[model samples]
Target chain A: MSSVYVHFFSVSLDGFGTGEGLSREEPFGHAGERLHEWIFVTRGWKEGGSGGVDDAFVQRHDMGIGAEIMGAGKFGYPGWENDPDWKGWWGPNPPFHTPTFVLTHHTRPSIEMEGGTTFHFRDTSPAEALEEARAAAGGQHIRIGGGAKTIRSFLAERLIDHMHVAVVPILLGRGERLWDGQEGLERDYAIESVSSPSGVTHLTFTRR
Target chain B: MSSVYVHFFSVSLDGFGTGEGLSREEPFGHAGERLHEWIFVTRGWKEGGSGGVDDAFVQRHDMGIGAEIMGAGKFGYPGWENDPDWKGWWGPNPPFHTPTFVLTHHTRPSIEMEGGTTFHFRDTSPAEALEEARAAAGGQHIRIGGGAKTIRSFLAERLIDHMHVAVVPILLGRGERLWDGQEGLERDYAIESVSSPSGVTHLTFTRR
Candidate 1:
């Protein structure tokens, strides 16, 4: 059965998926590259990075993932819609070798990037976007790429079937928070947490 | 050397030390002991709970602690200051077998309880309260007893030397958040995370 899940999502101990003041130069903003340092040291990140637990988790990002639904924030920095030629943070060849749906209020033409990745702009709710992505997924699972708000929206609506969040042991203090107002979310899921040697705790929640 | 630390502090995956609508009947409130279910099943919480990892962590709550600094929220329900007769949530004999300084703007006369636990109210900052608590600690380590706000206050001042947070695998969408405005706090601490068999990730942050 095809499942909708989030893989390799990193959040601070304070639960900020991304840090404050996110911009083009500082994609993760004040959090900078701190939140992702664990994965960056993994074999999946650098050419000679270690192939330990971190790498194993990083490798799952693309496994059996046929489509992706990401918020506009994850697609580009704020105000990216104004740039008519903006593709994404990723260059001509994005890592996502699948049909990717970017949820934005502003619509744009589909972009065919290098490899199998294609960016399709959609101004739809999570469910609506999931429907289109599921069709394009070809029976494979869809991944929810997030910048906190996007994932919160999906989780709030009970749309996320499985979620794997890597909790980086840091405090961002002031930033966009991942968990807010989605009270009683635990009732629907069975959650487990395991710590990796790389100093990140992976929290996996599967729908009950 | 005496160190300031929190032990066996349980929080929701969202980083809420305590949940919404806390009162006399429902201490953890809407969370309703759910966040502590893991510890409750452990021997440390029961009369004959297992002396496993969970119990070992829980037992550390009193080791080498001479005094405790707790937020007023932890002392009692909201507006507890108004009730002059209110001793605390704990009956005549509280678990804190030390001088417990309650950080509250509304100061009250000291109340001595059984088992060496004494409640002293102080209208002072985290630093000032720590100074008083340290004196009472009699050269022993100080425990920061919290309900989230108190710990955040100490973390904001960078006064806490060590912190042990037990991440319970549940989401309390609404509550007093523990990690607010302490951005980049991880820079000052060397953190390690380990998962206990009872299903809680113990995150230890020792100051660098």
Candidate 2:
């Protein structure tokens, strides 16, 4: 069976996946790029960057990922659905080179982008969305791409099989938190943690 | 000037310092010692236990601390004030071998315990309480013992000079959160993290 995975998802020390006021101009809102600065300094993001533990873990983001299911918040900015020509934050060739399903209320026609990435809109439950993404996964693993709420919903339902969360040391006082309603999440998964030299702790949770 | 420190403060992965339904029987509430199980097996707590990273950190709880200022919640149960005979959760010889100040709206006369630990109740702000604890500290650092709200208040005022938080990899869906309203706290502190082999990440914050 193909595993459901969440890789390299970053959250602030206070558990905020994204900061307040997320807009097209500031995709991460008040958090800015602080939540993901650990990745920016890794060899996976830039050449000649540190290829230490952080790079070792971040570089695994694309391994065996066949399809992705992301929230509407991650598909684009807050009012992105109103704009007809908004492709995505990622330029022409997005990092996700798979059939990416965007969970949105306003379902639009599928837009095929360059580099094997196709945006498919779906307004459905997490279980339903996972089933659809599973069918499109072609026997490979499915990646649960998040802006925070999407991952929390899947976690609440115990859908994720493997997850890697990079906990940034900074605190984004106010924003959408990732662990709000996940009370007994530890019951289903065996968790492990490792801190990096860049001051971020990588947490991996594998289903028991 | 004496520095204020918070040592061996434990919180769930979701940032809950203590669980819900806090009462006399369930001191940590539904958390039920879950948040503190890491220290229970440490050599600091037991005679024959692991003396690794977790033990090394837990043993520092009383290091160089002349006085302690804790919240009312940490001192006793919710309605302990109503009962005139209520002393504290700890036995006659409490772990704190110094003058400990309890911040409570219902102030009481000082109680001298078996050990050097003397309970002094004060209804004052975090700064004023620190001033009293500082004087009582006799040039040694003052410890900010917590139950979450007290530590958050001290942190909000930037009164704590150092903090060591043990992040346990469990989610207590509902409880008192430690990180709420503490946005951009990293600006005031230099933070570092180390993941212990026993599955807890120890985070140390030094005032910048």
Winning model by lDDT:
2
- DockQ, each predicted model: 0.79, 0.91
- lDDT by residue (B37-83, candidate 2, tens digit) is 99999999999999999999988876688999999999998999898
- Distance (Å) between predicted and true CA of A49, model 2? 1.3
For residues A1-208, what per-residue lDDT tens digits would candidate 1 score against the true structure? 6899999788888888887788989888888888888988888888999898778888877679989999999999888999999999999899889999999999999999999999999999889999999999999999999978999999988899999889888788777788776666778988777889888888888888
Q: Which residue runs of candidate 1 sit more than 4 Å off their true CA positions?
A: none
Weakest lDDT window of 10 consecutive positions for candidate 2 chain B: B56-65
Best by TM-score: 2
Write down the TM-score of model 2's second chain: 0.97
